[model samples]
Every structure is written in C-alpha cells, then in structure tokens.
Target: MRTLVFLGLLAGFGFGQGPQATLPNLVPQVVSPPDFPPELAELEGLHDAGRYREVYEKALARKDAWGYVLASYAATNYARYQASDKERQDWFRRAADAAREAVKLAPGQKGTPSLNASVEAKAYFALGQALGRYVQYAGLFTQALLVNQIRSAFSKAIELAPDFPDPKIGMALWHAEGVARNICLIFGCRRDQVQVFLNAAEAQRSNSKRVILGYVDGGYANLLINDLKEAERGLTTALSLTPKTAEDYYEQERAKGLMEELKRRKGGSR
Candidate 1:
C-alpha cells in the first residue's frame, strides 16, 4: 500500500478550521467478502512469501482482468522496495497500465455481468493506488491534472463497495492532500471534505473488521488538517488494533512516527 507521506508535513497550511469537533460514533456498514479467485489467491500467497517476481509472472500468465490488477499490485510493491527511482517509475507505470486494463475488462461498465461487483471494486481500488503512485512522481502540473482521476477511481470503488474502508481512505487522502497542495485547482472541493472522508473511512474500517490502514490514514489526514487531538486519537486507535498483514505493520510504524511528531509539536506549543 502506498503511504501518503507527502501529506505528512505541516507546511503551507491553508483553509483553517477551528478545533476538531467530535464526530458521532458511526458503526461501520461495509462487509468485504472474500472474493479473490484461486489464481489471485496463489499470487497473494507468493506475494506474502516475498516472491514478487514469481507473483508478477504468474499474474501475467493468467491474462485476466483480476490477474492484471494483481500483477499491478505486485509490480507496485516491487517498485516500492526498490532503491532506484528509474525502477520505481517503470514499475509504477506498469502497474498503472495493468490497472487500466483491469478497468476496461471490469463488469457492469456497459451492463455486462461477466465480473461481480467485488471484483470490479478491487480493480478500481488498484487503479486509484496506481494513479496515486504516479502522482507522487509527477511534477506539480501533472499531479494537479491527475487528482481528479485519482478521486474518480476511488469514488467508483466506494460506489461498488460502500463497506470497504480502503477506498474511503484513498478518497480522504485525495481530498486532504489535494486541498493542501493546490486548493484552487480542485473542483467543488471543500475544506470539510477531508473530515467527511475520514469519518466515512473510520466507519468503514470499523464495519469491515479488516486492516488497520483506516486509522493510520485518518490520523494522517487529521495531522494534515491541523487536528492534533484527532490525529492523536486516530493513531492511538491504530496502535491498539492488531495488524493483519506486513502492510498493516508498515502502516503501524508510520502511525507511531506520526504520534511522535504530534507529541513533539504539542510539547513545542506548550
């Protein structure tokens, strides 16, 4: 999972709001079904075993929509751990291409029921992540241009799986970082949009009973929006939750770092 590390900074703050207001305790309504195909499962196993190249190769061999999405995910991870910028760019582009292919073959586009809603949602989520990675490497002009695409892809994923927490996190980050980077360019973007998405993400995360990324993401968004109290609460919640995967552990570390930063900032203010 790509971390929105760019949003970690508190610089160039805009769109000021008052102290974070308390959000009502919302029960999460989303339930993600185990919808991965056998082939995809095999790819995941290989990926979990740190066999990225094999996962990529097997995923490519499958030559299906899900395969492409899985391949994109594997490629993205391979790129993530690499040291070279050129390699990262190449792999991210490959991941983006595969995700695009998956979208084209996704069901319910032209009223085709070939693929189920869950499958289609996964593809859109993958595409959103791929686009986000691309945005990280892109120049300011290019990043500005791709923000809408990122938001749209994640929105489609949410439309497909309202209960899924990942897309909501993605959407929240999109709003938070988009506003932070260039508020004028975002269409119909509101300063409160970040809080809205964060609330949704927290609800989804609670409802889904899955990963811990939601808390980490929400905490990071709060940090970006200068909601220190909320940031602390969110990250602390994330730390208390059990991580479900290596990715979750990675996010936990990030949350810890952010918590430390928050402490530093608070102490400085005092």
Candidate 2:
C-alpha cells in the first residue's frame, strides 16, 4: 500500500513533522497475490524493477480487469514519485479511473473465487488510494466528500475480503487523520475506531499482510492521535521485521524516520 502524501501538510498542525517524503519515496517491489496470473509476470517484473511508467503502459496494454488493476497501481506510483505538482493530481485521477474500470470488469461478490475476490478488492483499494492522495490537493469540502468515498471503498473491500489488511490500515489512517485535525466530531471519526481497525489489521500479519510500510503507516497514525507509546511500539515492530525486498528496506527507512520523530517529540517534552 502507498504511504500518505498529504502527511507533509500536517507538519504545521503539530503532526507529521520533519523531513518531507513523497508517495513513492520508498523503493518499489512486487508482491504477487495468491493465484498469480502467469501472463502478468512481465508487468510485475517491470513494477519490481521500479519501472513504473512502463508498468503502467504495458499493464493497460493488456486491456483486462487485472491489467487495469496493475495500471492503477503503477499510475499511483508514478504520480507519487515522478509527476510534478501540476501533474500529480491528473495521474491520481487516471489511477482512480483505471481502478473503476477494473471493478467494472471484475464484478464479483465476497464468496467468489479467491482470485476474483482479490482482484475486486484490489480495485477498490486502488481507488481508495488514489482518492486518498487526491484529497491532499482538494478544498475542505472536497476533502470531506472524498474522505467519505475513501471510507466507502475501503469498507467495501473489507466486506469482500475480511482478511485483507490494506483497507483496514487505510481506515485506521482515516480515523487517525480525523482525530489529529480535531474534526472527528464533524466527520464522525472516533479515536477508538483507529485502534479497532489497526488491531484487526495486525491480526492478519501472520496470514495475508506482507507490506512492511503498512506498519509504518500504523505507527504514523498512532503519532497523529498523540499516542506516543503506541507509536514507538508500532515503529519498533516495523524496525524489527526482517527485510527481504527493496520495499522492505525502504519501508524500514520510513519506520526509522518516524522513530526519529517519536524521539524528538518525547525528548522535547522533558
């Protein structure tokens, strides 16, 4: 899952302070889902190589649901790392559109085959991720609207695959962001709800959860809520995890960045 790009904006709000990080600031790698498609290995290879633009182009070339899904993923990455300020939102919009196309093509329910369910859930997740990034550039009213849609997409993804942790982490981020901004009362986000979703996600770590940045995301969310102890715990867990891929190493770097923030916050109060 992609990290929050809007977080840098929170620096002025007494959260997410420190060095600015972009969405694709972390190294890229491929994580194949169960029932991996044999034909898509080349595109996956491109993504794993961090050739995001080529991945997007070749993925959309296939013109299938899975193709669109990968296209969305690649486009999101490209937007985060490569696009200029003026072009970033356009790429995110393209990503969201590709994800919508993927959902339209997949069209399945919770009880469907694992591959179908995974594809549909991924499409929803991709859509939510794109919207999440886009919200950073939107006005407050647009942000409210986008946040609701992000919640809806994430909730639907969870309903489809109860074990998938990405959407859960996304929901946790949503609640945390709302709490940090002190807008929970107006938006209906609760502090407790953050832990609820985060715990649910951590429970799946032994099963379906693979990305390490999600742990960084969890810690970052905790930091947003002023839960410094939990923030340290989450970042510590991320640091302790053995890294096997470029994504792992880069995510740990992110965790380390958060750890620095955690340390500064703790030390300054003394």
Clashing residue pairs in all predictions, respectively, total 1, 0
Give model 1's TM-score versus the native structure: 0.77
Q: What's the TM for model 2?
A: 0.81
Number of the predicted model whose TM-score against the real structure is largest: 2
Q: Give lDDT tens digits, candidate 2, residues 73-107.
A: 78876776556678877888888889888889867
lDDT of each: 0.65, 0.72
Q: What is the C-alpha RMSD of each candidate to the true structure, in Å?
A: 9.2, 6.1
lDDT of 1 by residue, 228-260 (tens): 898898899988986544445556777778888
lDDT minimum window of 10 residues, candidate 1: 14-23
